[model samples]
Target: MADRGAGTMSLPDDWPDHANAILALNRMGSFDWDLDAGLMVMDAQAHAIFDILPEEYDDRPETLAVRVPPNEARRLDATVSQALKDGSENYGAYFRIRRRDGTQQWTHTQGYIRRDETGRPRRIIGVVRDATQELADIATRRERLEQDTALREQTNVVQLTTAALAHARTVQDVIDVLKDTHGLTHLGATSLVMGLVEAGRVRLIAEGPAGSFVAGTDVTGIDEPYPMNEVVRTLSPRFIESPEEFAAGYPILWPHITDLRITSAAYLPLIVQARPIGAMGLLYNDRRGFTAEERNILVALGSSIAQSLQRAMFYEQEKDIAQGLQQAMLPRTIPSVRGADVAVRYRAAAIGGSQGRDIGGDWYDLIPLPGGRVGAVIGDVQGHDTHAAAVMGQLRIVLRAYAAEGHTPATVMARASVFLHELDTDRFATCLYAEADLATGVVQVVRAGHIDPLLRHADRSCRRIPVPGGLPLGLSAEFGSLEYPVSTVELDPGHTLLLCTDGLVEMPGSDLDDGMRTLTALIASGPEDVRRLADMLIDLAEERGGDDDVALLLLHRRGLDAPVGGGRLQQHVAPGDPEALHEARHMVRAAVHTWGARDRADEIELIADELITNALMHTEGAAIVTLRALAGGRRLRVEVEDSSSALPRRREAGESGVSGRGLLLVDLLTDDWGVEARGGGKCVWCEFDVPESDRRRPNRRR
Candidate 1:
């Protein structure tokens, strides 16, 4: 026995029986462990505590392995080794040991290390006891029952949280889920703080409880004294059971959160695949300490959160990449056109679920062409992915090039279709291209498996222009339907022409025609400003979210600062095509009458017929006839173009000859005539002066 301090009792060195009696009475046993000799000496009472007889006892600790399970022995050895290496004065642990009857019993052990003068551990004095009865007592059973109930509640909360997190597709969405009123609060947390590990630093992504966030903590080092950092570093959970423990363990983080009145917290390492990706802290104000079961429950919850957060992060990254690619594929900016208010817009799709990316092939462009013409294009590729966007980019470039090459509307569309088919991609696109001559208010529109363009009248009423179309780009060329019909429409001053992908007019569960009619009504009631009208349509599409993208173009013809009533009309006349020549005559008559020159409609139609007839008879190609009301409706000019460089000369015609009489009639009409050399062709133009009374007449039809 060692000497005792004042007022304390001491036993003589020879009082072994007294110490044995005290240990036996308490159902505890004492042992002496020699570190240098690797041996242990246990008394009869200690053998009894281990449920072993005197004959079964061993002087060496290795011999005790027969009584202690291998797992229990290893755990005990490790605990002892850690305590000794850390210079711990004492250590205690609980383990399970199999008894002689093949039954498991809970056992506890405590050891006090004895160090020599040189500070090296020499021996250990310890006590072993059976803790089964202590653990099975009435109070402990009741406490464990409460802990079990709390575990069930916590598990339920975790399930609810996981369900909520399933819908989170972005990092911000994850934060919103965590900060939702009905969220994480069910986990018995008064406040929550979460951080993601980024580039060896923990970024504070979420902090709640309204103003509890400390400034300058948005990012922190992993080696900081904060409990979150501690768990992340160790890949283990930390239970701060009291404010005192929290303050002592995290001196730097305590002062900032003292005002929160937090009494306890649980910090968990958000680990996946045995590596920590981030960390989370659940703070408590009403609770004082956490039971072992509660700590385990929180750790499980943290694992679920880690998986969801990783998924959300990956989704956001993919979305960003998809959007960036789509934006790069689309036109960077629209070119301004003279004599028109042009507005263009594009919106990407809002796709959901594990698809992870939201992008599509919708695109719009404004291409300036030769001869005072501008091409407005709106198209959508067949899919919603990076591949579709790539195809769209190639198709848009080719379409622009064809339009800029002075091709007619139909030729441009056919060439684009051929280009797309030759690209060898298994994709197709619906497209509409409108070539408008702002000077003449004439729009030649060509459609390729796309919806009709909308024409808003000067009165703000809108209607669909039913343009005949061929198959979509790739399919048309594949099926040999390369001829796209062009429809001509007059875009009067103050009227607008609208072209958009079907995404703008499609409504789920509704017929496409019905959707178009609805769109027409919407446009009719929308504001008159082109830019504002474009915004309104796009905003509506955004509000009615769908799994498709949208592209739109609006071209509003500005009222010219010159004349108000005069107009121009053009028609292409092919050789030996009576219908085209007849259309050319009708166009001349209509333009003359619409310009209030009905009295001269007969003369104008006759002269236009003779010119078209001569061009068709003498040329190997088609004739283009153009009629214009000039000088504010006081004069009308007719021009006929042919792919021939030869100039026409007056010839004497006998009474019965019809071939040489065509140019003679033009000389007989009251008009000035001339010829101009065009590229590989010639244009013969004539002008007619109208009477003032007829010019001042109201617009009328014959």
Candidate 2:
């Protein structure tokens, strides 16, 4: 090549063959711009690269400019101007050109700037190469990389969420963990909502952001047009990418969406083990589409969420069962009698400040015993789960059985300890038992590794009874029946007796002693209303939120009235002896005459004879008779305590033999007569309504 004209290259005629052969190898050719001549020339290959005929050979700048897209032409012009100004030897740019055939091609065009001695441009020369294939290849690779990256990210999210969901025991627990770093962060979920199919409706039990249909709101049937209900019915996933779509898809929910500011939302059925349990939902603040991968991830999580929701429901139902079983094992009501008022409170254990799930094994009982005596017991088994509650239930039945057998408090606990130990439950229980005699104002306590009793006297002074306690039942016991030491304390008139499980007093950062002191002080200055006092004590104990279940028994000794020379006497009679009946009658008559109630002596004697006779007949051991003048001698009570566990019940004597009518006769003779259980025995007792009273007499102990 040589310059035959001003600043232009001239090629030999043979150069065409070599240039065309090289251009064929690389889809490239050469072009020249002769600025001084104001002419442009293209090689044969350049003409073919532009997809033009040979007649297009007289190349002016406009000739190539016509093929360049406007945007590419401007960009090329800028690059050329910069190159010329910078006086660069060569510079290259890539741009798109539309061929004469109306097809676009990407060309990599590089040009050289030739300057004269005065640094002025003479001619421009450049090479044009087709780059369309290269550009398409790069784009293909980029798209493939993006897909792989998306797949990896989704896999990571699924792995992390599955691990987290494994530890979630409840639906709420699962929901709470999803917002942690790796979870909802990738989900882009502004709100997480859970819907359960309850009673033929989709109910939102829990939600996030506290919006988008209130928590616990119900979505009705498929005809309702709620996305949640639709998902539940169809067992499929719903995607509303825009508010308009949502409005169209769920016309009934359009206003709700607007009110909730839900730009986009999704509803997916919560299917567990291939069964549709409910629907789960998510809400977003921006209108967005769920990626195929993202929607798949949510669908996978659907199973886990459904399982967790079912688990939470099962947990609650089990808690109900445990609590119901625990309560059913205890007394439903206690006696309301002349000398005492009783009340009880029982609460299961709490977990994380929520009251349910873990049922504490605690129990309380107020049993009516022989001789107008009432027996009270409170106990607790270790732990706060179903097993503990079951053991607590069994142990409660054992305690009641023992207490009803006419055993003393110590005797009952001893027998209970042996029973639990021999049963091999591998558990332990702390128990307190007390029998209070209303007539004498005496309370006998038996403790087995239990909290001490709180006694608040008439002066409002409170003290914990110092009873020696034995080991907790079900651990190693003494060779025989495990007997705890009996401690006696007089609960006089106007005194309050408090017995409770450890949960009442024990709290975090506080031990049994600290809790006892706090409880004692709280009850000491509290009101005398048995119900009120029970509530106050529990409220105070629950103030710090204990971890254990609590059972509290409260009894206030009724204030005694002034006795008007009425007598109080108890006689012990021998077993298998008819003389026991005679002795009982004599004692009743003597008390009736002494109390100026001789007008009722015959009735009193008759009732006393029946009670003692029943007791003696029903027992092989001795019978103890107690006669008391109550309500200012307007009420006479004759109680017979026997050493037999057999409780005498009134039945149809049926004209067979004599003596089946003993309780019947007493029931008719006395205002009231009922049987009370005692240690190893039971008592058949009767009360007589005294006909007369003198109100002006001095007050005395009956």
Going through the candidates in the order shown, the clash numbers are: 0, 14
Best by TM-score: 1
- Residue 129 lDDT in candidate 1: 88
Off by over 4 Å in 2: 1-186, 198-201, 206-211, 214-217, 222-226, 229-236, 243-263, 352-357, 401-405, 418-428, 471-478, 525-528, 540-543, 560-627, 632-702
True lDDT of residue 206, candidate 2: 53
Compared with the true structure, what per-residue lDDT tens digits does model 1 show for residues 1-702? Answer: 211111122223444657767877899887777778766777666776678776666467887777789999999999999999999998999888777898988888888888989889987877888888987795688987887787777788778778988888877777787777767787778888989888888899888778899887889898887788788899988888899998999898899999999999988898888878889888989989876777777777788888888888787787788889889988898887767789988888877555536888889999986434689999999998888989999999999887775567888888888899999689999999999877677889999999999999989999999999989998999999899988999888888999999899999999999999999999999999999999999999999998899999999988764233356678999988888878888888777888777888788888888888889888899999987775556677888988899999988787787667767788889578878665567788888888898877887785
Candidate 2, poorest ten consecutive residues by summed lDDT: 693-702
Give candidates' CA RMSD values in order: 17.4, 9.1
* Model 1, global lDDT: 0.83
Tell me the TM-score of each prediction against the true structure: 0.65, 0.64
* Cα lDDT of model 2 by residue, 154-238, tens digit: 7787788877766665556766777677776576677777667767766666566655554225555544667777887788899
